[model samples]
Target: MRKYSRKKKEIAVEDYVSGIKSGDRTMLARAITLVESHTNRHFTVAQQVIEQLGSVKTNSIRIGITGVPGAGKSTFIDSFGTYLCELGYRVAVLAVDPSSEVSKGSILGDKTRMERLSNNPRAFIRPSPSSGTLGGVNRKTRETIFLCEAAGFDIILIETVGVGQGEFVVRSMVDFFLLLVLTGAGDELQTMKKGIMELPDLVVVNKADGDNVSKAKQAMREYNTILHFLRPYTEGWTTKAVTASALEETGLIEIYKEIEQFIHMTRNNGIFEKRRTEQLKEWFDSSLKDKLYAQFFYDEKMKESLLQYEKLIIDGEKTVGNSVNELISLFLNKKE
Candidate 1:
């Protein structure tokens, strides 16, 4: 019997760029993997690929979807994404799954739940692990979105891991933010994160079919009343609540229309361009901090010093504030 080597072939940076630009899904997926990787080699290659691609500025929309657990988010995305594909838009769903703290393992099972959209030719669904970054959102999600857009995805849907601070983080990146909710508004509102109510541009009361129709409508009304009192996240836009049934595929068109109207209004008011500029600046600042953090923590000397400092602190030989100052000075001196 002949033994076969199982090593995977490494793609060239040029190939990655060309493949992504030409809308090759395989290359796009691989490029996203490169960006998501923690290794130094992968980071260099990923940055080269991204820089080569440049700022695409494609005619695209980034929509952030977040909701409470059991709010039927996957179901809604499946229905809504398929609907968008039918309207001749290539949809890309980036579903961020929460990772286990101990094992750092993620289920990444959004594809399984979004059966229809997963199978659709015009739709692409990528499930990413939060990997303990950005509050249950994939750290490389912004880069992933750029790659997807270069691959001709006109509609990008970022589905965050439930409702939490992750929604706030995702809101900063997307053009529109949508909140999905179920009946029992009063109880849910009480349990939600403190500033979450002020984040969404639109709130949908889902599962509005058969027995739940009346309850969903009541919930919608309650949400609308609450929303009426709060300021809208976007200027000159009214954030309202509507009822929808993912199972029945009802009210999806209305949701789409609302989004369409929003994009139009924002563009006319110049708020769209302004927001994108601010987002790009924020991304730069965030990337710089991440790079500095990696450099300091991953440095051999720094790691050794950290261990010594940690031990000293645990032994009550060094104060935390003093240790931190010393570490920073040491790191800067090493760089010098």
Candidate 2:
């Protein structure tokens, strides 16, 4: 006879707090899982954990890294993060993986890609599924950042799922935004989104090694020329382009120094503090919207009405705008 193992006991809120405070990796991972849960029971526990640990503040900086496909984002992070670790900084990488549409499962292969950093004691890499969220980011990413900060990681790196409108979303939540590009800027820029070029705090022409060094430098020069004409995303700062080779692990220090300078300038000028407050407000507003949407859609009466309205709209019996208005009115009336 095959016997199934019994369910493990649920961890208490205090245990989660204590484990995270003491830097227990397992506990930190579990806490993040709880935060990512969509179930009501888990949501209640997660909220309680976040509320109790709200005072766990640290001098942490969240840097978002995004690039076009095949831009070596994971490779670059592996090198850059290892460098930060060597410099005595505890680094946390939140790698957002795209979910499979059919199965809704993520490969979560960041640890495999960033082998060196994954094995480093000072580095913590958490791979989360985007779960079809707008911007290809995990819905609970901001909350995950809070948990990482509470776990005493001073350097938080967010690797977005490719580059697109996700750049704007990541930029809003992060203190710094980095864009990576390959050689041949002339060709790449044509295909790149105009809005994306304006978002990066720094642009790096990666893969600058071997026979590609000259091309990489030329690309960097071209990027710098383009950046010169565009307004920098951060006020009181000039965004520039540099070259780096993740494979050879060269030019990492330059990137680190550039980020350090940006952080210093932002902090001194009060932009850093102001941005953090804005991020909190945005998180609150977004969460409120999410809860309201869930409440309306999950209501049994609303569900029945929604199905009827959907059928009518699909069959062209009712106008979409009118159906939407009726649905909103119904939801509001139900609340009353």
Candidate 3:
């Protein structure tokens, strides 16, 4: 292990903040890469960056976008983000890609899909691997959001891995959640019936160009009917569905307008502050749980005992639940 140097770390953090303030894209990317690193020395450096950036933190609008595979999320973000930048909003996109368990590598092809926005000076694109973490969010994502905010990005967009049960995780971290759907699938209503649609403040029907335009309109009608039966998650705010052609760059302005309206309504109604407080409480709880689990696994005696319990369960000497209970008891009862 390399010896930790406080002074060197401070200098690096200062450079990072300076680059961020001046809108240096390369330095922004390097800062995120450094923060995502797992080594102890890098962790210290990352913390220093966070502390230095804490004072002038960015208060950007955080938007979470999610959908099933093939819903054109990247295309939508690229077009929509570019539109935001054109309107003079600095945008930062954090695209989460699922990790391959076999090789522990990420495809991370979001930048390829978002060609235009990736090259924009006002936009920053980051593709992070899920790394088998729960909630489809990595440990570094929230930190990266902070860094981007500090960098003066007025709009922060988070594109989640559009896999099973991940939208809920994304919802916990963003101010507004948008669910994208493709039209003419006949299953649009069915998709909306799933839990993912329930969480979205706004549902967008993408690919509304070509022959799908009428069908997309019909799908929006169907979604409106379905939404009637579901209770709104945020008080005084009803979830809405709209259509857009991301490929043709149509209807994006209305989408942004709707988002602005939602934010205005929620903030005025005090629901936004309430949701943020709840989110912070959940974050602390989840962090504590992860730390406790790590400590348990790191303890030599507890690790050995866990292995024995696993063997006993496999050999039919104990049931899995009972073994886990005993292990938890042993871990909790241990003295320093």
Q: What do the candidate models score in CA lDDT, each in turn? A: 0.85, 0.84, 0.76
lDDT of 3: 0.76
**Pick by TM-score: 2 or 3, better one:** 2
Q: Against the true structure, what is each candidate's TM-score?
A: 0.88, 0.86, 0.79
Error of 3 at 310 (Å): 10
Candidate 1 regions exceeding 4 Å error are 1-6, 97-110, 130-139, 300-336
Q: Which regions of candidate 2 fall more than 4 Å away from where they truly are?
A: 1-8, 97-110, 130-139, 298-336
Candidate topping lDDT:
1
Give the per-residue lDDT of model 2 (tens digit) for 65-92.
Answer: 9887788988999999999999999999
Clash number for each model: 0, 0, 0
Candidate 1 overall Cα lDDT vs. reference? Answer: 0.85
Of 1 and 3, the candidate ahead on lDDT is 1
Q: At residue 66, give the lDDT of candidate 3.
A: 85
